[model samples]
Target: MTLDRRTFLGTAAVATLAAPMVRAQGKPKVVVIGGGAGGATAARYIAKDSDGAIDVTLVEPTRKYYTCFFSNLYIGGFRDLASIGHTYGTLASDYGINVVHDWAVGVDRDAMTVTLTGGDTLPYDKLILSPGIDFVDGAVPGWDITAQNAMPHAYKAGSQSELLKAQVEAMPEGGLYAMVAPPNPYRCPPGPYERISMVAHVLKQTNPSAKILIVDPKQSFSKQALFEEGWQKHYGGMVERIGPDFGGANVSVNPDEMTVDIDGAVEKVDVCNVIPAMKAGRIAELAGVTDGNWAPVNASDMSTKADPDVYVLGDASAQGDMPKSGFSANSQAKVCANAVRGALTGSRVFPAKYANTCWSLIDENDGVKVGATYEATPDKIAKVDGFISQTGEDADLRKATYEESVGWYAGITADMFG
Candidate 1:
């Protein structure tokens, strides 16, 4: 069997036994929804490991998948939009997997079929939902998807990232830039903070006098100390944050007016980045698997608690301890692929292990990271060990950390698409 660099790294750690699969009449069908880190990786791994033993179909609307991870760097001018975009051509041409570019509008659990917006229904023995996240209604009063353009979230990457960057560049001299950070359990714990660093980097070079204001509901956040230290050192007095004590939790926005009302104090700003409360994508709720917000899954295999044949990965799954990150989704995909393949093709199933790392760039050649190792227990995916960059790290170490993230991005994309 052949494996790519990312594939080898994920599978080399696992020990398995190859058991002969018992084929009844035809191959078992596997249908996967979404094409981001989790779904794409799962589709690739299942097709590769099964070696034509299972029929895999990937359902996603976009031809090119844009990563939410590292998008802040793009906003900060570290990378172009093209570098983070990936397509499914290789998965279709090389893996012999059927790729359907359509929105999965419905899922019938009793009939075990998926309905697409194109008026087509696909039958499947097993289904994988990795549709990422969607904002909750009334998450932020006076803001909805219609207001996305004026107050762009840029959380899903792609065009939103581009729009946010363009808006930042077009800001007037000494303009105020505000960000309403999301609450906990959102995609990428440090994402909003990382974005702040990126925005500050751009403002420093272009509009030196422009200031950034953060309206955060949480009292503390991931890598708070590291981010605060970097902000003071690199862009001192240019950034201010209002935590819950300052009524950051109570916020509303008027996209037309370009104003943020925090705790009844209205602040006019040139640009507003609103990241509201989030939940699993709509498809998970449609499939009857989600427990209100996220799908609960078995830690050992990532199978949804609602149904044995349905598996949810990435930001959509309530897997304990792991932050919702691109690296985390990719990690969960491999474990899920192993279990799904074993169930269908009678292949070797190994115990589940997961890992994730989130790297953020504070300034030129300055990077910080947080990560952990997880193992499956009877209850959830429990954290075993973890590591994070310290507050006063040397410049050389920070640069090395940034470079490591670049390499990981290249490798993980290959593992997902190919």
Candidate 2:
């Protein structure tokens, strides 16, 4: 039998299982929705450290999980799609977690249970909701989920990424490539810019005469100067960014016509990537944990402000001072795991300290990053200190930064899946 990476990891770990199964004895139950960074890490830590004291179950609809981190590299031709795909086998067999591949359609807070789309009710003592994000309805005029096939967001990081890559690769020489950037507080502050950089890289080599336009609703963006510098250095005279003051505010896309309307000015494009405004995923809304667009959580332990037993993490969470990046989600998961275990078993819970680093690849072996360490405060997660890639960094330092990102990807995926 040819065991894949996931199968091998699961089988190897299970062969040496030492922890006893205590689920039949009615241990404290923890159910985590969404098997992304937050939910996967939380479930694994809760089950692994509990020593059969907790029954951990993770519910995610997808069989294969793709990390949004480094997905831009896939589009940039720096990575293969399979390199970023992960499986839940380790979480199930190795960590003694009940991995349920089903959508959690509703949460019955009063009943202390979650309702699955298949008509099953899962009772839990504590619930962790990390259902990522969902685009707002009609956030982009003439564009919605239905139009995704034509104007790809590629934010979800799978086939969409491949689609966008194909669209860009197929553009004719001297063609136009346009991107509609999202508003504030979306996932990955530096994401759209990094994508633009990657797109420009591909175009620079394939069709130098092609043009790339970024229509941004905000006047400024994360690591703006650094990206602008990189754009100028690597793909000069090919990229243009229009801020809100310049008609970026009023934008509409016609997927059928491959047209973009910016404040009554229309432009036709060869390729369009429309990233609409987003909020917490539908499961979070169904769980009744969201305030406006995001779920508000206590800074101390990521517990939802609505219900203490329920917690929210990752892009769905509005915890302050942390960008909605995979690193942030993974960091929050560890903290939440510790808190949940302490609440269940009287374990010592330390004060919550979190950190996140968002790295973007501007070109081959060239990267930029922004990061900070955070501490939980009475109101929110406040930044203690932060740092960013300075503009005009030397080539060696940029190469090192890009290498560090490669190492981080390997380490983080191992930490999450294994």
Q: Which candidate is the best by lDDT?
A: 1
Alpha-carbon shift of residue 201 in model 2 (angstroms): 0.9
Candidate 2 Cα errors over 4 Å, as ranges = 1-25
Error of 2 at 116 (Å): 0.9
lDDT by residue (tens digit), candidate 1, 1-418: 2224665466533344466666687989999999999999999888888888889999999998889988999999999999999999999999988999999999999999999999999999999999999999989998999999999999998999999999999999999999999998899999999999999999999999999999999999999999999999999999999999999999999999999999999999999999999999999999999999999999999999999999999999998889999899999999999999999888788878898888899999998899999999999999999999999999999988888888777778887887
Supply the global lDDT for candidate 2.
Answer: 0.90
Could you give candidate 2's per-residue lDDT for residues 238-346 as a string of tens digits? Answer: 9999999999989999999999999999999999999999999999998888986999999999999999999999999988889999989989998999888888876
How far is each candidate from the true structure, as Cα RMSD in Å? 2.4, 5.0
TM-score of 2: 0.94
For each candidate, give its TM-score against the true structure: 0.97, 0.94
Worst 10 residues of 2 by lDDT: 8-17
- Candidate 2: residue 409 Cα off by (Å): 0.6
Candidate 2 clashes: the total is 0
Q: What lDDT does the true structure give each of the candidates?
A: 0.92, 0.90
**Model 2: clashing residue pairs?**
none
